[model samples]
Target chain A: MVPPDERSRALVSVLGTAETKVTFEDPRSIPEMVLAVVEAALEDAALGWHDIDAVVTASVDLFDGLTASSIAVTEVVGAVMKPETRIAADGLAAAVHAVHQIMAGAYRRILVVAHGKASMAPYWDLTAWAMDPIFLQPLGVNFLTFAGLQAAMLARHDPHAVSRWATTAALRRSAATGGIAGPISVDRVMASPVVASPLRAGMCAPVGDGACAVILGDPNIGDRNLGEEDVRIAGIGHDVGPHHLMIGELTDWAGLRRASQRAYTLAGVTKPTFAIVEPSCLFPHEEELFVEAVGIGTTAPHSPGGGLFAGTAPVISGLSRLLRVVRALKGRTGERGLAHGTWGPAGQGQVVVVAETP
Target chain B: MILESTIRLPFSYAAGTVGSRFLIALREDQKILGARCTSCSTVTAPPRPFCSSCSRTVTELVEVGPDGTLEAWTNQPGNGVFGLILLDGADTPIVHRILGTINPGTVNAEAINMTPGARVTAMFAKDRTGRITDIEGFIVEQDDP
Candidate 1:
């Protein structure tokens, strides 16, 4: 449903999701992981390295513990002589940026690569550095503690909040395929040791190392013979809330609501209806916020692929959700699907992408 | 095979004009300063250079309360109690540790007597550096009859 002028700029289509593995231990270097995903992506797209016009990557220098971390993967992504952009945030944001470049007629084909390895160092320790040094850093607050704060606030509002979170965690983990975490029960979830009060260890997503790459191209530049399995990016939108957690309402995700509204408007979807929805919810409470912000009623099918609850790399979680949605649409699981990604403390950054079968 | 190595990277961080001023206030006068945005009439604690809500430069500096209300709190496993405190004159809350001998990690509501909306007063450390840790933490303020 992209407008006429925009449609000609580039008909952005997702070629495929490539080589994503969730594991606590990946015996591969950062560049090796990048190469693996890039190779897999090219093979799935039925194209060679020469076909890619530009590259966009997502990785945090802090997480990688290197300066200009993207430099390590540039050669593998086939960006030695081409234009490459790096997003220090989540991978879904990088993909959305790639969509803009194609729509602006900058390039016909753009390859998006995102990678994260939680095994590199203390993940939470690095995250603490992202906080306001003067105020937050001294308190030793990290993403997990922030999540705990949000969960406690939500618990104050709803009496059965902890129980609901436990159930959601159990269901998502059970539905996960190729997940590092096995199926867990609600009782086990409740009995699990508390990471943050009101949020048990079982309710948190398993963080691991993984990489994902997707090749997108203008429909005209690619093969003329189109197939029913191809999926097109119908709409995309992203938003960043205040950097400080105290600035916004802790209970609701206003940023996601804004992002999803923009995407829905571009996709010309007046109703909150979808065949499938995949949200990068690192915690069960976050899934509740996503559903409320996106205005998807309780009946809508959500995260059939298990979402982040299964096991997701920190920075790669969002883009991986997109991969799941694309695969679902291609497999005839849904005609229209929604994928959501988030970053920063307490969902400060949000992105929504709407994909539909061609 | 499993391989492990430690890599240490050294770097220095600069706290700009706004941050420097906040630190100076704490070091010299033991005062908490916040910036007030005239456009939005919002006061942000620890003073940011710009008003996030209005997207305008905030030049007016105001001294907020040594007393505040706890908005939310959590007890870290090894660490002590931490809470988001809404200072008396500021619109935004500041995250800090709660100072007390009683550990909220193991105590219940009745034992700790700390909950959301509880009144607390800032307690400064004896050895003050121009850092955020100058104010050690907040303690429960007893009500006067």
Candidate 2:
């Protein structure tokens, strides 16, 4: 546990995973998936539900096809009769909000949870609703089309962008071990059937259902329940770009750059460098944008565990990346890492987190 | 047992003053309207009530274009071609369906005459409903000999 004097604010730790298919025969319900992750998080933190003072959850009402989707997980998250806030975007954004609560001295320990089940509804079809109803939606411009437009623009900007993206997709998939979808070669990626023009089937992250839970607390509480190793959430930042695609630059993730700058400033990172970086890159081209926006060298260790290409749940992808970094830095000393998450068309919303082994 | 049920959610969206006027223009005059931000001088098609850049409430509605240039485009499998068109007078491009046949599936440089910088003009539907779809789609403007 953290000492009383150092009880200002910190993400005590995190835990979770993503699966393309939860079960072979029967698919797990939303609450069931959320419960499993919550229980595992408590186990990892060695804390009980009673110890959690507040809860922050990430879920989209349209994705669940139910209003107040957070209510579905309230009982499982132990948020009944307690303060619970829901973030309708990526899970990492929810985690960032929970950090604010701890820092404000509103809660001693906060539980952050996120879940997404793509099997319930047609994922891309639901994404269309997120578009401007009057203008873009009527034209049938969904997430895939927006991605196609961006990829096409990138290709147009750089003649070799298509081949480069194919290489990146192949590398990421090949690095994935025990993923639901197996690896592919550059040739195979380039030859794969086109879903959206330049974006091949192999270049897109396989969508799936998943749930993640992370527990954050003051340093004093963390130090009390001392474990073999400890990782602290040093800083967190998130930004929302223009909702309309016409308003912002399609190729550059300016929002991510702003978010990362805020996070780096808070973490006292003068030079942006990390031992490992896990980016929620849903598309191969997005990984390229992420690297450029975050100011990380091309050779920097990125998504060693294959990232979203391996198979990522929609809202849960970002939080899962955080979980990966936390777990990776747990035993190591003097190691720092970064995890990035994005939402909306062409990554309009971005969240970044900086962490270190203490 | 697999239980199946269809959920239909009924919603009523208030288009507000700006949207209502824009729709009226499209339906009555077959004219495209855009909202001009006085602060930033940026015009957005399918006119909105507010400007995104300068955070100013825009009340001036301007007639933009019957013709526009295609900035980017894609072919949606079953759906016909669609492209982002920067209408003649608007600062931003509006995404709309492209009528006429060139290619059917996949977004390629050669498909549906969908290269960047292509010229197109609005083709209004015969039956107007004061909705965005009333302007059925955009047709590629042919070059004169």
Candidate 3:
């Protein structure tokens, strides 16, 4: 028995990939936005419809206002007649699931994709559904509320937390937007009105529509046609914590701690100091939470310049982090990088991935 | 232009399964119940017959708290009202409407503030319906009235 904790597996590399082409328009339609991502992934990977073996997509059916929304997305990703699986969490969750397939000797290669657009429906509405229906629904709670509660908790203790979050948001947004969305200044973030106590509009992640795609395959049959530069995935782990935010200790993300410990063991990471970390931080405060939970402290440069506060593509946000790690590692900027994704209120579900340069 | 039509999805609760029976019980007596996993001894609200963790059928009935703490709260921007709530007894949280106006300043005040850890109590409608909405929603308590 591998023993659940010490289960080490061989590494797999992420093949050529592409990010969604930004179309600066409000209320972006799902079909229109998703097709662009599919087309871009196909073009970037230099692969046609015939190259893909199976497709794995991540999406929440309720968010799309359609049940089994993955069915509609398959055609765009070229998954017609291919085995498909839908993950109800972040894009990174689907990517991790794909890695499992490859590790289990099930499929040789797979296409992992995820998409989310806050334009089609209210993002808050979608987040609210994740709450307890009988008790929390009537109260009308959403993710932002949790952010507010966390902010309130921080504000009661730390004097500089809110200001620091504002600074982080401004810095990230500036780096992510280059003739993309209009530049937002630190002054703008400071001046933005508070949506929830202690959390301002600028501190929160901007809702945007986008899609992400990643191709994975065994290294033995490494095809030169699919980009020579490869970033290998060394370790991956995920955990779900207590759903009730109030009952569990909010300050500590124990779920993240356990997940990172598992991932580091799998990746043989004795020391994570030199690692470049890419984390899915919807809000600046969340960035702090993720960093603290992973035990990286302030030692590692996170998101390089910015994160989801830069602009989030919903379910695709986590995979966006993975892509960021891939780009950074391929550039020789970092030897090993940590990418983390969190779902539900106060980080209910957590996933961690460690990517290293081969 | 692509043409689309509005699809109405109307479904009913058969209450045949044990999970449905519990829902029926909640509607009949405003009793909140949960299914306890035989293997792990974890009680799940929105009860599940099969333990998600152990993959074993949960046959034990564990009546959790009729009241739960308000873990989180929010108001729909427009149209209808909704919130995410975790009940006292069950492991899973349920979403329902708040009985009265949302108060932002004080916990569960008439205003629109959804502070975490706000104390809330469930309110059932006079008419009985074997659906999740039968509870109408939960209300944040100001004090013993």
Candidate 4:
């Protein structure tokens, strides 16, 4: 028999969630953008700024082009005097930290926020700075190069991989409702400029500027809007794979698999039977890798409304995915949802969170 | 209206003991080096202090290759063509330029087979620096031998 998770003693519920429409460039500054999301999230949770006990945020200095970039959201997230923790990776990772604090009975309510702006500079250019200066960086190695290399590795065995990726990108784009790069044809996607070998511009997600905020709290704690049914986080697991793309499993997402397995065990999910799945796949080829890693079979409703293909911010992607799952669970359909996040070159870091209506 | 500003920040990184050894060998003797793991037996080129897989400190630095197999490649239209080369002795691949001919920029990409499993030999630069660029690129092996 599988052992039950002992550390998750307290059930952490997501009280509220909010996000901005992802755009190529947000007109407002970082603080103003964060403030809007914070206000909406507070309103959704029916809590005042004073009610927030602590704040956790996800951001990166290289992406934000500012040291301690999380400072921008301090006043908005109600962290002026309270303790605040900043995670330099994906937004969902911050939520995971918030979940940890809530489970530890550290605070009654914690606010998690993540923000990113691709428009500030050439986003891909910034990623090159993260690679090994001694070996990879001088060779002009960047994240896009990593994607192309992975796709090329996968295409070696499968003759039809390229065509399939084009189809997947087209499907995702067409399904997107308000996506910046709306509904492109499969033919057009194939003909689009090749950013990397075997991967085209159309096969990539539309990156933009945005912010996401979510409030988590202990249901046992008394609040004015206490409800019997709430969307609670059931499980969370994160794993960082090998940093080097060459040495690691280039064709598979080993880290994501392990993370999902750990999360599944905590959530008591015996199979890949999620009502909805939100994965942080930046490329169309990655959608295939995500499916294989999570072991989600043909039936799971994955990435509704085109998911990241619709358009998402860099650090905010994983967190925004969590928000989507939270919103869907509010219907109280007894549905189980999965939210995933990834960081570093390729799938170097992977985080998974499981949520359900209770 | 959009205002753009170009900012330049200079930085320096120490190559460390193992990294210095790897680069020194490439420059001094046109030889590729890989650090073998004490625990997992995995060898990673452009060697490091510890193994990427097992996290065990690697002490045995072995010669990897002047010849390797092309694992995968990409041709960025404006940028150059690059490939993942699986060195002869090493288990893992390293990313580097895949030079099709004497002049890479002018060569026709389709003329050369960019597919995996093609054999290639490393070409070293005449004037070498203790850097990754010491090995200029790998050229596809000719069959006329």
Best by DockQ: 4
Q: Give the best candidate by TM-score.
A: 4
Residue-level error in angstroms, candidate 1, position A163: 1.6
True contacts kept of each: 0.48, 0.43, 0.10, 0.67
lDDT of each: 0.82, 0.79, 0.70, 0.85
Query: Each model's RMSD to truth, in Å?
Result: 3.3, 3.9, 5.7, 2.9
DockQ of the candidate models in sequence:
0.56, 0.51, 0.16, 0.69
Better of 1 and 3 by lDDT: 1
Which pairs of residues clash in candidate 1, taking residues 3 or more apart in a chain or in different chains?
none
Error of 3 at A6 (Å): 15
TM-scores, one per candidate: 0.93, 0.92, 0.76, 0.95
DockQ value of candidate 3: 0.16
Tens-digit lDDT track of model 2 for B1-145: 4456677877777778999998899999999999999999989887888885677999999999889987776666655566778898998777778775323322232334555777877888899998898888877754531
For candidate 1, write residues A210-285 as lDDT tens digits. 9999888776664642455688887888999887866355788999999999888787667767777999998999
Per-residue lDDT of model 3, residues B1-145, tens digit only: 4235454776443444766767787788887777778788767776666664565888777776557766544433342344445677676555556555334333343553345566777777678667666676777665533
Q: Model 1 in CAPRI terms: which quality?
A: medium
- Clashes (N, CA, C under 3 Å) per candidate: 0, 8, 34, 0
By TM-score, the better pick of 1 and 2 is 1
Compose the digit string of candidate 3's lDDT tens values, residues A218-329: 6556566533346778789899875655334466678888899988888877666535687887778777778787888675677764667557667887888888788777
lDDT of 4 by residue, A1-358 (tens): 1124322322688889999999999988888889999999999999999889999999898888886786577777778889999889999889999988987889989999999999998888789888889998888878888888899989998999999999988989998998987999999999999988988999999999999999999877776665656777888989987667653478888889999998888777786677779999988889888999999964556998798999999899999999998887776645678999998888788999988765
lDDT of 2 by residue, A2-100 (tens): 223332234544422222232212277888888888888888777888888999999998888787796689898899989999889999999899888
Candidate 2 CAPRI-style tier: medium
